[model samples]
Target chain A: MARQTHTPSTGKLPGVEKCPTGIRGLDEITDGGLPRGRPTLVCGGAGSGKTLLAMEFIVRGIRDYGEPGVFVAFEETADELSRNVSSLGFDLDKLVRRRQLAVDHIRVERSEMEETGEYDLEGLFIRLGTMIDQIGAQRIAIDTVEVLFAGLLNEAILRAELRRLLRWLKDKGVTTIITGEQGEKTLTRHGLEEYVSDCVIFLDHRIVNQIATRRLRVVKYRGSSHGTNEYPTMIDQHGLSVLPISSLGLDYGASTEHVSSGVDRLDAMLGGGGYYRGSSILVSGTAGTGKTSLAAAFIDAACRRGERCLYLVLEEAPAQIIRNMASIGFDLGRWVDKGSLRFHGVRSTLYGLEQHLVTLHKLVSEFHPPTVAVDPITNLMVVGETAEVKSTLTRMIDFLKNQGITALFTSLTEGGGPAEQTEVGVSSLMDTWLLLRNVEMGAERNRLMFILKSRGMAHSNQVREFRLSDQGIQLRDVYVGPSAVLTGAARLVQEARDKAQAVSERESMARRRRELQQEQALTRAQFEALHLKTAALDEELHTLEAEDQTRRVTAAGEQAELARAQGADGNGGLSKKGAKRPADRYARA
Target chain B: MIAKHATSDTELLEEAARKAKHQKYVLRLYVAGMTPRSREALRTVSEICREELAGRCDLEVIDLYKQPTLAHREQIVAVPTLIKKLPLPLRRFIGSMVDKEKLLVGLDLIPRTP
Candidate 1:
């Protein structure tokens, strides 16, 4: 479908040829533009920018397309029209002087005239035809043609003449735009839509929540298909621009490149790298959870890479943000001075949601930055509802993605709820989400960060304690105590207690080893003393054996002598018994 | 029509009426080609000028078809539009000039109240 619209030469449908209006987003939505050589009725209430649209059509046609135009104003004089649009940089007077445009103011006063016989609006035709011929115009605008109804008394003649005028313009082959005031039950006050039937566009200006938003919608197109959504329109210094809520479809290309999240540990947690180059990143946390600091870091990293970065702040001034970031060791002001970072600080309630979106679009186009950061997008919810903010963000994200720009958005999630949930409901649209949380433990609050989800990478699921110091943001592994994840003072206290317990256990093991060595040494000493005693006893026994041997010999000799007196064989037996008796006595001793 | 009683008050009123009638009036009638409405408007305006202000009125009839540029220059939006020029307070009337009374009143030939 995109290819069909972009390549008109090959895929052009058999429909009315289009004349591009040269508007920002109008041509994209209208398929091409209003049907060429046919009248388009633009009807709206006062202050709804009907006249401005018609004037811009003529001016842009003359300037951009080189097609001369004629503007027949029934309400404002030519000078008034010129002066009114000068703010938009359209020099109507100059265009007229160049002979490229012709402005004719048609004034009809009913009180100055008396009708008695039949008449036609041939005089108006001659005037218009003469002007068209004078400028060789290819386009014309008749602003508020309904004023003719009030100026002329005869309705029947006016209606018939109006019909004839439209038909004549069509026959002339000049694309025409006729404006009318809105009516109660009809598209136009005098039903001008009935006459100019080829196309019709409606402009609406409505106020919601005290903010004004202008919208444009194509009500009908006879021979073409057009976008049916009510697109938001804005009239800024440049001109009127229609902002399509979203692109025709989600066909934007996804990039494979990676861009840093500015925090090393964050990059590690996000699967060894950073987010996709053209992806949207959401940093959601409760108040005072350092959402802005994370965004600033990302912007700083982008700037350091020599890529342009746009910082859109809604909650703080640029100077204040720079100062605050400087305290965190991030010199954002240096990037700003180097012209790599641009700060666009605006109050969230400064305008409507649509206006903010338009401003963002304009800024992005003007700067053409490769990276953008919107700090605390939650503040934008103050101006619009959640759905509106979400839609606006979706469009913003889509626009950035189409340009292959990496975007970081900070959202202030209310405390006590799931930190992963973004209140604006844009978490689904983000490709990467990093959640920051504050855990209160042991009378102190400590920040913790974890990658909630990273779309296309391996990420760590461990929750790390987030710390901010004079140096910068630091992420440390949170202590998993026996019962809970300890942080802040509790983690410090637990670490100290564990170290002390280890020290005491080492000291007790050393004392037990010393006691075992002393007991073994005492037992060895006792055994050595007993061996010495046995040695001394053996010496005494040897001495005693020497003496006993002599005594036994004497006894044996006496016994033998006695035995010799009796006989030789009995003496030998007695001597042997005496020797055995002496030996036994020695063993018993 | 005037009452000729010849009283002093009547003579003063007649003198004032004569002066008002002698005032010069310049009128230009713009028409588109020779259409029926343009022809009728031309005829009615000529008769009104001849009968009412004969020598005191100056009338010029312009055809938009011949002088198409004049339609834009004169700011003419309707056919058969008569613009009273030389009068101090210039006035313009549109449509076919068949209603002679209204034309006379617009031309200041008849008192507005009457």
Candidate 2:
């Protein structure tokens, strides 16, 4: 995805010029293709794609760089070579007819030939020169030139002639590629590497655990710095493409833009509306924890924004994924129909790790999508070891990032393994990690999700219950009981219990208010009865006081009358009586 | 037994002689200019044609330097290559052709030993 603008014509280097192969990743690794106008040796074992690589170089040179070439086929005939490479869409015959390419098949049968005396391979030189002049070719490919070793009996002569041939090609000033079969100790069976010393590349096809992977390496490049790492190469219907793993540098531009995650509450949990543009997001969970659903939601959101998206499914077919997503109200089928969403489904066992990576590269480059989703990246582990899968994913992530693409990858963790750990160990490469887990309580399993990490954003750390309903994915706050985090039926039961307790407490308070009112009424009635009794007692006392008053008044009046009736000394006696009566009345009062 | 062996040897010789008389040898010698090796190869082939094949041999010597395209057309990788085109099965010999026995055998004029 690192856009290669440094062509051979525009190379900035001063000393050694280059000839761009026009291959997908070859130019980037070779720092602008093989050394210009020099002989490069491409050696490999049988069926290691040596011939295809050489053929593609010539074909691409003619088609892309406008450099006429000649292909010297020593093993297969011109027709056979043409038929073999036709699948890659390279019409050799058409190129030949147009005088842009020439295919010369050199067939030597040892049984049909007799070597009596000394002979140089000047005839081959004449044939090559004539072909080169026929089309004014600037590039040449001698596919497996070692075939001469099998046909000729004299090794010393063949070796010397091959050396002279390479020197002759160099003197001609044409960029040439000579393929040789891998030898036991040397780089080539015929030791052709000893002759073409400008550049040497090795192609390897290895089958580990029944999965075949092809790798390419630049063994030596004189006066030029080239990638030394073994790059994973793949040959498909589109010809040979080498994946330069180390060519990706951490220098891609980081965008500050944000894209939605589809789930509103989940977006809120991410702090800023959504993820950063061109950032990688990891959604990891155990089985049935809605990892795929979460990824689908993101894809749906991206599609809704009118951005193209690519969904790579390894476990499920495109139709199956669409159908499953439809159950959650995601109309992915419509997006696919609208040409905004592309689904590429392939089984993990269908190819090796490198093949899958190459396929990913091919698809992405072809589709040029802004967003990509790889559902269950852990499924790739079936084809490769853990380290290989990690490396592949690393390259994949780097590629996506270099393209400024926002990618979402879902990882399926083992049932009992720690949900935070990914088997592929790609979490460190993600800009955001969303962990989903299953919490078992009340004899039922419930889904829970929490943001493990989100770089450059303040994300929520609180766990939330994850639900998938007919409407869509929903994130609800987890219920925290006295002992543990409650979910599902357990949370509902606890809520009901709390509500019942509140209701009973309110009812008891109402009963207490009625009882207090009855007690107040009883006290008031008892006091009223006591008041009436006191009033009656007061009336009786008043009546007794009136009777006593009357008695005292009658006694005083009789004393006064007696005092008035007496003569002479009666006045004094009457006065005395009055005083005595007054004294008696005062004593009674 | 010795007499029977001698009679069989004579019969085999007669059969070879009959095949050689009827068989026509069509030969092409590809060379790079008139180098010593090319001239020597031409001389050796002409001598064989005159002595062994007589009137039944047709030999053509091509200089690749003059007609360079023929090298690729004929699929010739070695210089002084003699191609027997008309012996049912084609055969080629590369070198100065100083060894006539090998050339005769390749041209199917003489039966190969073992």
Instruction: Find the candidate with the highest TM-score and give its number.
Output: 1
Per-residue lDDT over A1-589 for candidate 2, one digit per residue giving the tens place of the 0 to 100 score: 0012232434566646789999888888888998877889999999999899889899999999999999999999999999999989999999999999999889988888889998989999999999888888888999878889999988888889998998777767778899999989988887888887789999999887788999999999987898999899998888889998833568988998888998999889888689988999999998999999998999999999999999999999999989999999998999999999999999988888999899889999899999999988999998888899999999999999998999999999998888789989999999999999999988999999999999988899899999999899999988887787898888889889989999999999989998998898899899999999999999978886777677667866766676556534556655666657655675566
Lowest lDDT block of 10, candidate 1 chain A: A1-10
Stretches > 4 Å off in candidate 2: A1-13, A246-248, A510-589, B1-13, B21-24, B54-56, B109-111
Error of 2 at B71 (Å): 1.3
> lDDT tens digits, residues A1-589, model 1?
1222232323456887787888888888888887777889999888999988888889999889998999989988989998999999999889999999999888877676666666788999998888888888888899978888887788999899999999887777788899999998988888998887778999998888888888899999877888888888898898889987666588888888888888889888887778889999999999888889999889988998999999999999999999999999899998999999999999988888888888888889999999999987888898888888888888888888887889999999987777768989999999999899998888889999988888988889999998887688888999997787899889999889888998999899889988888988999999999999999999988898898778777877777677778876855566777778867886677
Per the 3 Å backbone cut-off, how many clashing residue pairs does candidate 2 have? 0
> Which one wins on lDDT?
2
Q: Candidate 1, which segments miss by more than 4 Å at Cα? A: A1-13, A415-420, A513-589, B1-18
Interface RMSD of each: 1.4, 0.8
* TM-scores for the candidates: 0.87, 0.86
For candidate 2, list the clashing residue pairs, or say none: none
TM-score of 1: 0.87
Clashes of 1: 0
Give the per-residue Cα lDDT of candidate 2 at A187.
82
